[model samples]
Target: MIFLDGIPISKWGLQIQQEHDHPAVPELRRKAMIIPGMDGEWDFGSESGPKPFNFPLGFIEYDKNEKQRRINEFVAFLLDPYGRPREMKLSFDYEQDKYYRVKIANGFTPRRIHGFAFFDLPLIASKPRKNFMVPSDEIVMESDIPILSDLLWDTGFSDRKITSPQSFEIINNGTVVILFSFQMEGSGDNVSFSANGKTMTFKNFANKSLEITDNYVVKVNGISDLTISNGIFLELLPGTNQITVSGSNLNLTISESLTYQYV
Candidate 1:
């Protein structure tokens, strides 16, 4: 798997397969010649015109036991128009006992490169960002009576003053959304979120139980719930900050301040 900017390319897969025993071992040696341009006519300097270009000549040997399983990996550093290296790999396996060699009869031809063109667009530079937000209308609430904040809404919270919500459940035919709510004031003086039975403290709030004091914490009153129905939901939980979401699903997060009300 090739990772580019934390994302992976999922479209590529193994293409070549090895061949078993064949009897043309002798005739192949005498007739074998690198076909010009991958697969085309062998220009043996016929009256047709000038001969086709060939690759640099080389040969490699491998153990007979490792013949069928090991492919000869060829990494070509194709020079661009400005003579910069563009990496690409080609792979295939051959019989071990056989004498395999390539004769360049001609120099390497830049035109032989696949997709090679005289005029091509230069590479573009851009920054990559995480797209976790889904549309709000697609979220579904699992609770019997969903509140306003619990309704589908485009919401984003940071790990700073306002701690992001916890786990969310997908609902409404797999539409994306999150459920979260916090009271504007009042509390045991602590605001936090729960994940897998563990409660993480939000440094911005004050907690009398732990004798910890913080001014940025917002005291939440009553049960507050928020739902993200369609887009991405990001969490800024202390020490466990992460983003949880699913394609076309419902996400739910319950604040610690409202745990007793829901229970």
Candidate 2:
């Protein structure tokens, strides 16, 4: 079974026959050149290309009269009113927890064969990756926590707060490095975030929320702030990433969504 944008195609009288393309691996986008004096090609690097998935769908309606209507509905769902393909969430029965961001590769037309209407549904994922289908698990760190010195003072709170300079570890179960974002707010003298050997410090800021986007864009609250240095965006490797945040009376929220770029 296949689901598009949380709606099953079977609802529109469409059903996959026997098999479909696995589409687990994406094509590599590698740049290489062979020099006249070199015996092998020079290796630059490679990125991922779009991934394609094809579904051989057959329309089966008990009443022959309803077949055309159902087919039209199916097409309407895949295309917008402007007759253009839209991005959709595509998932399968076997891996319900993951989904692909996809669009129709090309226009589809059903051909009548063996008393059934059949068509090839081609989907192309521009991201060339499958992501977790569920909502992001938000990890929030509040300022009410005891400071690190409290460990000796024996003044830990009843809540989940740990310390003033919060230190934590985030594990990326995926096989590739993935970018993450965080938002922090506090009235303080200085605040610093460290991860993956990179540190970003904001000093003398008050009553403003600082955000670092997954794309490495920094913003004061919702508006983009260009003053932040590049490469301050946080990232998690395949295994564990040690994250340290130091500030006075600050609250931080980190998004824990993980994306698997490869197997």
lDDT of 1 by residue, 191-261 (tens): 44443333434323232122111212323332222221112222222122232322211122322211100
Write model 2 residue lDDT over 75-115, tens digit each, in one string: 78888889899899998777765678899998778887555
Model 1: how large is the Cα RMSD against the reference?
Answer: 25.1
Off by over 4 Å in 2: 62-65, 135-163, 217-219, 226-231, 247-262
Clashes of 1: 35
| Residue 113 alpha-carbon offset, candidate 1, angstroms | 8.2
Identify the candidate with maximal TM-score.
Answer: 2
Q: What is the C-alpha lDDT of each candidate?
A: 0.24, 0.68
Off by over 4 Å in 1: 1-188, 203-263
Model 2 clash pairs? none
TM-score of 1: 0.17
